[model samples]
Structure formats: structure tokens, C-alpha cells
Target: MTGLLTDVPVDIDRDAARRAAAEELSDPKYRDARPNFLQQIGQWLGEQLEKLLDGLSSAVPGGIFGLLLVLVLLIVLVVVIRLRTGKIARAAKAERAVFGATRKSADDYRRAAAEAVSAGRYDDAVRDRFRAVVRALEERALLDVRSGRTADEAAAEAGVLLPDVATELRQGARLFDDVHYGGRDGTEAAYRALTELDERCRRARPVAMAGS
Candidate 1:
């Protein structure tokens, strides 16, 4: 039995194989056996997130439950930012002198409207052109200029002096109020309507003067 076992010649290097596997597991260069760069980054981020959550939990009342509150606050912040961006953009475009704030010349408003048209800001174009119409009537002495005079009032006052343009003035006022207060979207066609009315107001002979 001893002679047959010796002739069998078993060739096994278990110690060397074990050493190679241990080196591979410990070596940073052996990415397959060790944590890769992405895995390392994930571990670091996890540690930072844990530390942040711990700090937040200490700052607010309650323990880990505060983490849920923080998450809810983050979501609310995002929603508020989105809403402000959208509403402010709309308000900026719809703002005008008729809102009891700004005042400018007819030509100045006309130029601003033209610029708005060029920039594809149809809402601003509509607002600016409608302001131009009201200012044109004020400049022509057909309508009185006042700080709190609304679009409807301006149309009514101007219509008294220039009955020929009463229809156009009322239409322009409706467009302004629709976009500014009624939350209607301004369109290129609406802007053109105001522009045409402004041109008519420029040439209109007041009822008082037409009779003379």
C-alpha cells in the first residue's frame, strides 16, 4: 500500500493557492476582488448622507422621524420655486400702467410692443400694444390720464370723445383685462388687434372736433 501511494504522485500546492487568493483580495489594483472606484464613491456618499441625516435629526425635534420631515420640506421648496417661476413670468408679461403702477409714452409703449413681438413674447406684446392705445388717446386729449384709471374706464372715457373708435377701444380694453386679470393666454392675433386699434386712434378725429 505504501509503494502504490508513492507511485500515485499527488501534485497539490494548497499553500501557494491560498497565498495568491489572499493577495488578490487585499490588493487595491485587483478591482475584480476589491471595491471599484464607483463602489468607493458610493460608500463615501453613504457615509456623508448618514452624517447629514444625523445632524438634521439633532437640529429638529424627534429622532429619525425628522428625516421624513426634511424630505417633505425639500419637495415643498421645489414646488414653490416652480410655481413662483411660472406665475412671475405671467405677471411680468401682463403688467401695464392700467394696473395702477407704471406710466410711459404712447411711442415708447409702441416700441416696447414691437420689441416684444420680435422676441416672440406675444403676451407682453399684447399688453404693451394695448397700453399704447390708451396712451395714444391720452396724448391726443381724447382720454384723461390718471394713476388708477383702469382699461375699462379708459375705453369708456375715450369713447365719449371719439365715438368712431368706441368699438375698437372697448375691444382693446377687454383683451387687456382678459390677459392681465382673467388669466387668459395672450396671442399674436390679440396683439395685432390692439395694434390696428392704436393706428385707428392715431387718425381718429374726436366727436367734439368732427362736428366743428
Candidate 2:
């Protein structure tokens, strides 16, 4: 038994065996199968964030329970932000003027609208073009220049005077409300509609009333 054991020379030491295994696994196939740089970065970041959160949670009295509570709070915050800035945006348009309280003339508003359209800010273009329409009506004595008059009020008042373009006026008013206060993205179609409304209004004469 002693001779047989002595004859069997175990040349593979522990460190040497480890080295051999490492070299074998260092094959191009193994390296190619590993994750790329971006994937590795993402994985490392996830692991670091996990470690940080776990450490924070462990420091709290409720440990993992506290981590759950924090995650819930974060989710709630995101939801609230979406509601405030993304979905509902702000309150009714009545709280503001149709022309945004600016004292620009109808021509000035038209120029402003053109600039906004050039800048690709369709929302601003729609607002400015609609304001130009309202201001033109006021200048021509078609509608009174009342303070705090909303888009809806302006459209209704203008419709009474300009019956031919009543529907278009109401549509432009709704577009104004939809884009400005309803958290909707303005589009070129909406801007063109307003532009057409402005042109039609310019040529429109007041409806003849029985008393007049």
C-alpha cells in the first residue's frame, strides 16, 4: 500500500489546479458569452443601488418593512407628479384671459403667431393666432374688450356677431382650451385651423339684426 501510494505522484497542487481551471475557463467562447460593457454597467449599478437600499433599510427600526414603505412613498410621489404636470396640468381657463392678458394689437399678435409657428411651438402659435382673432374683433367693435373674458366667452360673443363663422370660432376656442389648459400637445393641424379662422374672420361682416 505504501509503495503504491508513493508511486502515484500527485503533481497537481491546489494552486496549480486552480490556475489550470482558470486558464481553461478563459477561452474566447466563455469571454464572448459574457455581458457587454453597457449590460455590465447596468448590472453593477443595480447591485450598488440594492446594497445602498438594503443598508438604509437595515439601519431603520423596521428593516425590510421600512424599505417597502420608502418604495411605496416614491411610487406615490411619481404618480402625483404625473397628475400635476402631465395629465391635469392646471385648473379651468376661466381663471385667465383668452389673450393671456397681453395688450398687443391684432397685427402684433399675428406677427407673434408667425414667430411661434416658425419656432415649431404650435401651442404658442395657436394661442397667439386665436388672440389675434379676438383682438381684431375688439378693434372692429365686434366684441367688447372685457377683462377676464375666457376663450369660451369670446367665442360665444363673437359667434353672435359673426354668424357665418360661428362654428369655426367655437372650434378654435375649444382648440385653445385643449392645448393651453387641457395638457394636450399642439399640432400643425390645430395651428392651420386657427389661421384659417383668422382669415375668414377678417373678411366676415356682422349679421344684420332686426333692430339695426
| Candidate 2 local lDDT, 1-212, one digit each (tens) | 99999999788889999999999999999999999999999999999999998898998769989878988999999998877766354443334468554579999999998999899999889888898999999999989888778888899999998989999999999998888778798889998999999999999888865356
Error of 2 at 209 (Å): 7.9
**TM-score for all models, in order of appearance:** 0.53, 0.54
Model 1 TM-score, 2 decimals: 0.53
Clashes of each: 0, 0
- lDDT of candidate 1 over 155-186, digit per residue (tens): 98998888888988999999998987677888
Deviating ranges (above 4 Å) for candidate 2: 1-96, 209-212
- Score each candidate by Cα lDDT: 0.83, 0.87
Deviation in angstroms for 129 in model 1? Answer: 0.4
Question: Which 10-residue span in candidate 1 carries the lowest summed lDDT?
Answer: 91-100
